[model samples]
Target: MNIRTAAVRILNSYHHQYFNYENKIAATSDGLKLSGKDRDFLYILVKGVILHRSYLDFVIEIAAQRSVKKFENTVLNLLRVGVFQYLILETPPHAFTNETVDAARQLKKPRAIGLINAVLRHLLLKDELKTRLAELPDNESLAIQFSHPQWMIDRWIEHFGIANTQIIADFNNSYQKIYFRHNPVKISWDDLSQILKDSGYTISVAIDSPILFFSTDTPGELIRSELFNKGFMSVQDISQSLAVRLLNPQPGEVIIDACAAPGGKTGMIAQLGGRESIVNAYDISPAKVQLLKNEAFRLGLDFVNYGVADARSGTFPMADKVLLDVPCSGTGVMARRADLRWNRTPQDLETLLVMQREILTNMVNAVKPGGVVIYSTCSIEPEENWQNIEWFLEANPDFTIESADNFVEAKWCDKNGAVQVLPHLHNETGGFAVRLQRR
Candidate 1:
C-alpha cells in the first residue's frame, strides 16, 4: 500500500499500538522504499501523535468548527498524523499535508480527504488551540501540549513531581536503548564488546552485571555474528538480570522458571546454576517452551529443561527454587510497549490479581518447603507487585518475606520487600521483584 493508504489502514486495524513506536518503523520504511527524510519524518510524526494524543484531541476540539471525533477512524487518525507532523515534528506543511491528503484519497475516501484537509487547514490558520493550552493549569498545559491524559500526568506529578514527570513523559516518546547480555559460559563482556565494536555497534554497560546497551548505525540483526550465534550473548535489560540474581540457582540445585518464554531468564538460570542441575523452565504454551529450549542451546546452557505447563494450574515438577516472573499488566514497560498505556484499565487489576494469586499459591507448592519463590514482573504497579504479595503472605502461613534489598543493592528498592523501577527513577527499565522463603 501507498504511504497515505497505510496511514489510514493503521488506525483502522486498531493494532497500531503494537506497531506504534519504533519497533515496526524499520520494516515499514523498508517495505515502502521511503526516503531517509520521509522515513525519519514519519517515525517522528507517528510517535508524536500517539504520545501526545490527548493534547492533540483537545487542540482538534478547539480548532475544528465541528467535532473531529465524529469522523471515521481513518479520517480522525489522518488529522492526528497530519497535525502531529506539522506542529510537533515541524515537518513542512507541503509534504505532510499533501502526503496525508493523498493517503486519504488512496484509501478510496476522496471525500474524507477534503475533511482531513479542512480540519488540518483550520488548525494551521486559527492558532486558537495553542493559545488556549498556554492559558491552562500546569498539568492541563502539559497534558494538551504533550498529548498525555490528565489523570496520568496528575499521578506522575504526585509521585515524581512536575519536572521529573515531564522528563519521563518525554523519554517514553523516544527510542529504547538496545541492550544485550553476554552468555557467562561462552564469552566475557570484554571479548564480546570487541566483537560488537568490529560490527559497528558501540556497547555501554547497564550495570556491574552482564547487561549492555548499544546503538547501531548498522542494523541490529548483525547479532547473527559469531559471538551471538555461539551463545556468547543474548539481549536483555539491566533490571531483568536481577531476578535471576535473586533466584541464585546453585550448581546442583533444582530450579523452575515459571512462565519462562523467549527464555532470557531461563537460559540465564542455566548459565548461572550450570547445565547439569536441571533448570526446568515451564510455560503454558508449547511454542514458548521451545523458545526457552532454543535460548538454552544458543547460550550454551545445557541444564535447562523446557516444559509446557502453567504455574497457576500447579502441574509441574517440584524444585528447590522457583522464579515466578508472572504475566503482568505491563504498565511498567510503557516506553517499550506504547499500546499498553491505553490498553490497561484499573479493572484489569482484579483479573490479574486472581491469576497472580492462583499462580503464586500453586507454584509455591512446587518449591521445596525451605526453598525460595522469587516473584517478579516487568511492572511497577503495586496491585500487581506488592499488594498481591501482601495477600499471598497473609494466606500462605508457611511463607515469609525476604527483602529484595537483602540481595541487590538497596539503592532502588521499596521497604515492603518489593522494588519499583520507574523509567525516570532508575537507569534500568521499569520492573518489580520480591523474594519469599517458605518457613
Candidate 2:
C-alpha cells in the first residue's frame, strides 16, 4: 500500500467526518495490514499534516499565489500532505514532490497532479515562504505558525499574555512523549522498569512519583508489549493522575467516578484506595462503560462497579468523594488529540459550559456533607476551570473551596487552591482540578 496515499484518504475522511483520529488511523492501519515501519510512517504523515495544517496551508497559499478555499478538498489535502512532508518531516524535496504527485494520481485526482507538483516544488524555496509569512500581522502570524485557531490564540493572549500563549502553542504543536502509570496492584514499579529495560526499551521514571514512567519509544510497541497486555502499567498522562491523587481515595471509602469512561482515573482510585474501597464508575455512553469495564478487568480491579448514566442527572448513592471529570472544549489536550484543535469552536465552549455546570451542580448532591467533589477538565480555559467552580460555589453555599496543595506541590495549585497543570510549564498535557468540600 502507498502510505502517503493512505494518509491522504484518512485526512479526507477526517476532514468530512468527526471521528477520533487515533481510532480511525488504527482501524485503517489494521485493515491495510501495514508493517511496523509503514504504520509508523503513516501515522507521522496523517497526524503531522493535521498538527501543522494551518501552517501548511499558509505556505501552500503563498507558493500557489491563491487561497486554499478555491482548491478541491482532495487537491488541498494532497498539497497539505506534500507540504507537511517537505517542511516538517524534512523529506527529500524530490521524493516528497514526486511521491505526493503520485498519491494524487492514485486517488484519481489526475488533474491535481500538476498543481501538487508545482506547490510542493515552490515550497523548496524556503526563503520566499518565510518572507511572505513574516509580512502578516502578529496574531495572524502566531495562529498560522502554531496551527491553532485565531480565536483561541486571541483568547489565550488575553488570558495568559503573548509569551505564555506562544509557549502553550509551541508545546501543542510538538509531539508528546508517552507516559505510563504502573499498576501497583498487578506489578511493582521496580519490576516493571527492569522488565521494560530488558526488553530493549529505554524508560525513565518520574522524579516525584515512582509509579509514573515516560518513554520516547514508539507508543504502538509499548501498547502491544506483554507487560501492557497484563495491565502492569497504563498509558496515562502525569497531569491526569493529579486529579485522582487530589481525590486521595482511602480504604473503605465509597467513591463515585461520575464521568468515568476510559477508566484511567477509576483504575487509579481503585489501586490507591485498595480493594476495600467501593468505586461506582459511570458514564453516559454504554460503549464507554463497556470500555471502562474492560480496563478494570485488565487491571484486576473487580471492586470497581461500572454503569451507563449521565452525570448531569444520574441517580447515585451518597459517597465520600465524587470525581466529575467533565467534558469541555478540550483546548488543553490539543497536542495529544491532534484533530481537536480544528474541531473545536467558540460556540462549542458555550454549549460545553452549560453541560459542565449541570454536571457539577447535580453530582455534588451525591457527595455527603463534609465530603469532597473534585471538578476537573482536560482544558486550560478559565471558563471551564476556576470560573465554573466560582459559579458552583455561589449557587451552593454549603460547598467550600479546599486547597489542592495538600495533595500536590504548591506550584501546581492556584491561589484559590485549584490545580492548574499547564503543558508548557509541567511538560505534560494541560488540565484543571479543584476539590470542593461540602460543609
Candidate 3:
C-alpha cells in the first residue's frame, strides 16, 4: 500500500482511544504479498505515531487555534500520525505533508488538506513544537507532560501528588520492553538461551531471575518453535513471571488461575509444579480459553484443565491456591499497548477496581483454608492495586500478609502492601501484585 493508504488504514483502525498495537496491525496483510521492507516500515510508522501521539496532538491543537476536545476524532488521529512523523520521527517535511494530505483527501476530507498542510509548515518553519509545548499553562502542561487526559491527571493529582501524577504520565509515553519467563520445569536457562540464539533471536538481559528479554518482530507464532513446543518456555511479563512464581505452586496442589487465558501464568504453574499439581484455568471469554488451550498444547503440558467460566458469577471446584490476574485500567501496559492511553479513564479504573475487589473476594472464598491468593494487575493505579487489596484484607482479617519479599525490587513499604512496578523507573511493564495467606 502507498504511504497515504497506510496512514488512512491506521486512522481507520484507531478507535479514538480503544485502540491497541494488536488491533492496529490485525487487519494488515501479513502474507508474503507485502514486501518485507513494506511490512517493517509499516510497524515503525504505526508504532512511532502511537508512541508520540499525545505530544503530536499538543502541536496540532496549538496550530489550529482550537480546543483539542472539539476536533473530529478521525481527523485528529490522522493528523496526529502525520505530525508525529514530521516532528518526532524526523520524516522529510515534503513527504510528510504530501502523504498525509493525500490520506486526508482519500478519506473524503478534501478540506482538511489545507489544515494538514498549514500545520506541517508551521511546525517545520518554527520548529517550535517543543517551545510551544514548554509554554503550556500548568494544567495543560501536566496533561501533555504525562501524555494522559487532563481529567486523569487531575484525578491522579488528587490521589497521588502532582509529582507522582507527572511520573505516571511519563511512564505511559514510551515503548515497553519484551519480557518472558523461562519455564524451568521444561528447560534450563542455558538450554533455552541456546535454542533461542540458534534460532536467530536477540536476547537482552533484564533481570537475573526467572525472566528473559528477547526482541523479534517475528510474529508470536514463531514462539511455537520446536523448543517452545516441547514445553521449554512461555512468553509473559517480568512482573507476571514473578506473580506466578510468588504464588509458588507446589506439587500435589490444585491452583486456579482466575481470568487465565493466553495461558502464560497458567503454563508456569503446570511447568513449575510438575504433574502433581492440576490447574483448572478459567476465563470469561472463549477466545481467551482457546489461547490457554493453544499455549498448553504448545508447552506439551497435560496438567492444565482449561474452561470458559465467568469468575464473577460462576462456581468451580475448590482450589488450594488462587491467582486472580484480574482486568483493570491497563495503565501499566500502555507502553506495549501504545493505543491504550487514549482508551482509559478515571471512571474505567473506578468501575474496574470494584470488579477487581469483587474478584479478589471471590478468589479468597474459592481457596481452601491455609491456601494462598495472589491478586495482580497490569495496572499501576493505587485504586486497582493497593486500595482493592487493602479492602480485601480489611474485610478478611483471616488473611495475613504473605511476604512479597521475593518481588523484583522488594519495595512494597510505600505501596500499601503490594508489589508496585513502574515503567519510568523499572524499565518493564508497570504492574502490581499482592499475596495473602489464609491463617
Q: TM-score for every candidate vs. truth?
A: 0.83, 0.95, 0.85
Predicted model with the maximum lDDT: 2
Model 1 ranges with Cα > 4 A deviation = 1-7, 15-48, 105-109, 112-114, 124-127, 134-168, 185-188, 208-232, 294-302
Query: What's the CA error at residue 320 for candidate 2, in Å?
Result: 0.4
Task: Please identify model 2 stretches exceeding 4 Å from their true place.
Answer: 207-210
Residue pairs whose backbone atoms clash in candidate 2: none
Which lDDT tens digits does candidate 1 get at residues 1-439?
Answer: 5554554454455554344445466567778888766666555555556666776677666666657668777777877777777777677878878988887777777888666777777767646775786789988887666555566678778867899777777766666776666666887767877877876675556565433434444324545356567877777766677888777778889998888996888877877777567788888998778877777777777756777887887577778999999998775666766556666666776788889888998898788889999999887666788788888888888888787776777876776766667778774567888888987
For model 3, how big is the CA root-mean-square deviation?
3.5
Off by over 4 Å in 3: 16-21, 24-26, 35-37, 64-78, 98-115, 127-135, 183-188, 208-233, 406-417
Residue 296 CA displacement from its true place in model 1, Å: 3.9
RMSD of each: 3.8, 1.7, 3.5
Ranking of models by lDDT: 2, 1, 3
State residue 182's C-alpha deviation in candidate 2, in Å. 0.7
How high is the CA lDDT of each candidate model? Answer: 0.73, 0.87, 0.72
Q: How does candidate 2 fare on TM-score?
A: 0.95
The sequence of per-residue lDDT tens digits that candidate 3 reaches over residues 1-439 is 4654565577566655546555455347353245555665666667766666667767777787787688776677668877777766788988888888777776778877778787778776554666766777766788874566778777767866777767667666655555556666666788877877888876765565444434455535345366656766666677567677678888899899989976788887887678888889999999889878887886778668888888887887888899998988887777666667677766787789778867876667688898888888888777777777778879999998776775445653234556767764666677887788888
Q: Least accurate stretch of 10 residues (summed lDDT) in model 2? A: 207-216
Query: What is candidate 1's CA lDDT for residue 205?
Result: 63
Instruction: Point out the higher-scoring one by lDDT: 2 or 3.
Output: 2
